[model samples]
Target chain A: MKKINFSAGPAILPASVLTQAAAAVENLDGSGLSILEISHRSDAFDAVLVEAEQLVRELLNVGDEYGVLFLSGGASTQFFFTAMNLLNPEETAGYLDTGSWSAKAIKEAKNFGKVNIIASSKESNYDHIPRGYTVPDGLKYVHLTSNNTIFGTQFKEWPETDAPLVADMSSDIFSRRIPLEKFGIIYAGAQKNLGPAGATLVIVRKDLLGKVNRTLPSMLDYRVHIDGGSTYNTPPVYPIYVMMLTLRWIKAQGGLEGMEKHNERKAKLLYEEIDRNPKFRGTVADDFSRSQMNVTFVCTDEADTAAFQAAAEAAGCDGITGHRSVGGFRASIYNSMPYEGVETLVRVMREFE
Target chain B: MKKINFSAGPAILPASVLTQAAAAVENLDGSGLSILEISHRSDAFDAVLVEAEQLVRELLNVGDEYGVLFLSGGASTQFFFTAMNLLNPEETAGYLDTGSWSAKAIKEAKNFGKVNIIASSKESNYDHIPRGYTVPDGLKYVHLTSNNTIFGTQFKEWPETDAPLVADMSSDIFSRRIPLEKFGIIYAGAQKNLGPAGATLVIVRKDLLGKVNRTLPSMLDYRVHIDGGSTYNTPPVYPIYVMMLTLRWIKAQGGLEGMEKHNERKAKLLYEEIDRNPKFRGTVADDFSRSQMNVTFVCTDEADTAAFQAAAEAAGCDGITGHRSVGGFRASIYNSMPYEGVETLVRVMREFE
Candidate 1:
């Protein structure tokens, strides 16, 4: 069966990317070497790193002031690395606890430096983004999660801050056009929309680094990667190569602006169906705060949840089960999720209704 | 043409492993979804993680005292994580400066706590493992690199010490049987003998954890990984899946003992050619210290280097070029390297002579 995967992360990739990646595993770009067997220092891999970085720059519309690094260890590690590199132990940083990911980042940041929760949507079960948050002066950076994969909420507007901004854009990184110059740092784990699970893309303003007041571990330091072109130590080559193929696909799809149009169409189609169907209720209270990346909802009668789940499964939908922490259905429509998949999901919802 | 790959790390993997991995990328075991699209929390991935860990335990003959974690970020990040989790800032750890990898680990360890160099071979350009050095008492752990990929040296016997031992077995893991009880921790980047370039296999004794006084970040802490079953966050799923497939292949090739016999035969063949050929000289002076995983040699005329490289390239031998730090040729005969490849390499050397 041709199934539509809606996994929140380590999620669906473009079908063409998967095909090319599989072939590359057998033989990479006619190099007579399997992509698995090639050295990271080889000219073949060097081209992959260069092209992937250039695509990230061109898509984000960033200039030389930004250093793009494809790292491993995921965004879970970035929570600590971001704070450790940007904030001194005695310094304070502002964080918005919008959802689970941001809350985790805030916890990690607190271990390195003092962290002030400038705004929080936790009191309302993170159903919407908090508004009117004050970015206090003297804060090293204002940390935020651009989109909550678990809660299915996204920041409609970023706070106007005196301090530099650091955003974890894991779920919605390339789904829309982003303002690169407004932020000091942006990082995303590649599994969602970029490529696979092994690489994280970190874009940082060059001047914002080297100011940390501690001796950073070589792997933990962003400066080490910026200086060495993400090969300070042996990098995760296969993942980066696959990411390059994905960027190539994204560029062909018209970059981030085109991605926004495609993703918005999918999101609107699903949301409209959710509102029209009497059997389903959207999880997020306000439509403005709903994420274009992950769409969450619940069966209105609650008793029909099982029947709806079975129906979706029978209709060839995968990973529609909601997060265990929050009980409901979540349909992740990342950049790669096709319009037809969303339409199929709507058809299933209507049939269930 | 199918080429014989000899890259030191991120080198050749089993042909069957590659085929299975490639197929999984398209459609995983009748799951109706690409392996790249599945969630780490899914049952399919859970089986992969379990099987990979079970295979490691069976091959290494380890018991419940150890925790096997499939982590991201490679072995480089482990340099600091190992130190941070084992040695408190007030205490010290012992390290043997055997080669480039161990030296890198020592530099990272210094950021966490005091490091005492118990022995070093740098005076001889890391041509052999240092001997006649005593391990001081009261150290937290004694760290070593089991195989020097760059210098082409391997430890024939481990240093005896009351302190817990830590080893970086990045290049030679699974090529032979290991004494798991003798070491408190063993870590390897999976690119070498295991599978791909993203996942790292960490087997640590449970008792050795939770001893460090520092506040370990959730990602850096071994306890978190152990408790969470290496899924505290989204793991490098594709790499881990590839590793599982490779481990399956290893079992089919008979276990570690079978691997030992196979690798020994390949290494002996190449080393014999280096010793007999008038045109070449092995890099490592001591015969007993030479590594079976990577064999480094130099052309006697030095001028013949270019011709030898070209001839090897023409003969379908890939990645035989040595590390830039030291010039000449390094034929990395990792576990996946077949005996025919080594025979071909030896034949190439003889023809040149």
Candidate 2:
């Protein structure tokens, strides 16, 4: 059976990226040296570092105003470091707690600063994005997750807040082209869109740093990672190199604008199928709540959902299984999930109906 | 040419581990699902977590007295966290400054508590480890990195100190059987001797918790990663999975005791060549030096060393280039590096002589 992956986060990467990464692991740049074998300080690997950051700037169209850092520890690390670097311990930071990831970030940020819950939909079980919350004055920054992967909901539009905006775009980054200037900092854990786990791509507006009153650890300090050129220590070399390859793949596919359109089409194919089939009902709230990446839906009869999953697996569409917290089905349609794969998923949904 | 990888980690991982990891990435557990796609919360992946922790404990002979955590951030993060967790704001921690990693670690620890340089070989250019130091009675702990990869020096034997000993054996962990009872904590970044970079292996004694006065970020809390089974949040899944395979390879090659003999033999072979060859001279001080990994040496005629490194690479022995700071050649004979590779290096060294 042909494998069509739908697993969230370490979701499908561009097949070309995989091919290049696998080849690099064996022999990088015809040096007969495995990408894993080269030092992060080496000129060859340094080029990988420089190109990755440059491409990130190019993709976002951000100029010298922002500093792109490739650092260790995933987005979870960023949840704390962002607060530690941007907000003083006594200062209050506004947070929009949309789902699990945002909650985790809010919880972590609380350790570093006083966090004000600007708005939360936990009262409604996060089915819809909360509205009607004021972006408090004197707030250090307004923090929010761009997309909630587990809940399968996203903020269709970002709020126009005067406060500097910070986002943990771990699950939905690079899937669409957003206005990069709207946020002070945007970081993504690379398991989903960029490459593998272990590496985090932190793009911070240069001037937003050095405001926090805390003495940060060197490793956790964004300035330290920035100054060290992300070679602060032997970086997660293979993963970062693979990320660079994936970024190259993104560029080859016509950069951010093309990827956004491509992702939208794939999301539409699956969402349209879910809505058309009476046997299946969309899990997320209509119009106000929908995730372009993770399309969650339930069978009208939940009993048949397992059968549908098994059938989908038998048909070679993997990771169609839904999250246990919100049961039914979730098809994670990352940037790398080919349109053909979504077409296959649509076929399965229609066949099930 | 057959590549003999001696890169100082993300160094040479076992070929078997690589093959299995590649296969897992392609197809996980014959479920037709890629390992990257599946939820870490799944029963299948949960088994990986349980078995990996169990395997490390069993391999290290860690009893109920110690808690083992596989954390997302590398040992670099722990450089501060460990101090913060153990040392009160008024208390001080003692450190032995061996080389770059230790110096970096000490710098971070200074943010949390008073840092006392109990001893340092930095004035001597980190070519050797300090001989003896009395641990301050009021100090919370005495921290030291057992093996200094950048400088090619090891403690050879640990200090006889009353204070708790914390070892960052990042480069040479699992290369020898540690007297586990002597240290309160042993942390190793998994890039060397274990698997890829990103995850840190922390072996901390059960008694050392809830001591620090200040609140720590959840990510920095060792207790969180340990109690949460290293899945407090989404872990560096691939890095930890690959590390498990590397651990399995270590066990198959006769565990740590077996690995010790294997490592000693490999180190002896290369060191013997450098000692005997008139053209090449060993860089580290003979009495206090490393054996299991990271052997640095220089040529009698320093001008010819560059040619020798080129020749070594041409001979398919890569990563023999010395650290820029050390200014000489280094053969990091990590556990995964085959004895045959070292022998090949020895042959090249003798030919140069």
Predicted model with the maximum lDDT: 1
Among these predictions, the greatest TM-score belongs to: 1
lDDT of 1 by residue, B1-353 (tens): 88999988788999988888888889999888888888899899999999999999998898999999999888998998899899888899999999999999999999888999999999889999877888999999999999999999999889989888899999999999887788999999999999989999999999998877788889999999999999999899989999999888888889998999999999999999999999999999798789999999999999999999999988889899999867799999999999999988888998999
* TM-score to true structure, per model: 0.99, 0.95
Native-to-model Cα distance after best TM-score fit, residue A84 in candidate 1, in Å = 0.3
What ranges in model 2 sit over 4 Å off?
B288-290
* lDDT for each residue of candidate 2 in B1-87, tens digit (9 for 90 to 100): 657888776788777777777667666678665565566666767877787888888888999888888875678878887888888
Task: Report how far residue A287 has shifted in candidate 1, in Å.
Answer: 1.6
* TM-score of chain B alone in model 2: 0.97
- For model 1, how does the per-residue alpha-carbon lDDT over A103-165 read when each residue is reduced to its tens digit? 999989988899999999898889999876677788889999999999999987888887878
User: How does chain A of candidate 2 score by TM-score against the true chain A?
Assistant: 0.98
The local distance difference test score of model 1 is 0.91
Q: In model 1, which regions exceed 4 Å deviation?
A: none
Q: Per-residue alpha-carbon lDDT of model 2 for A1-353, expressed as tens digits?
A: 54887888666777677666666655677876666556666788889999998889898887888889988678988898898899887899999999888998998888777999999978776777776667768888899998888889987788768887899899888888888888999999888888877688999988888877767777777887778888777677767887888898888898988898998899888888888889898877666778888888889998897789888987788787778878888899988899999998888778887
RMSD in angstroms, all models? Answer: 1.0, 2.2
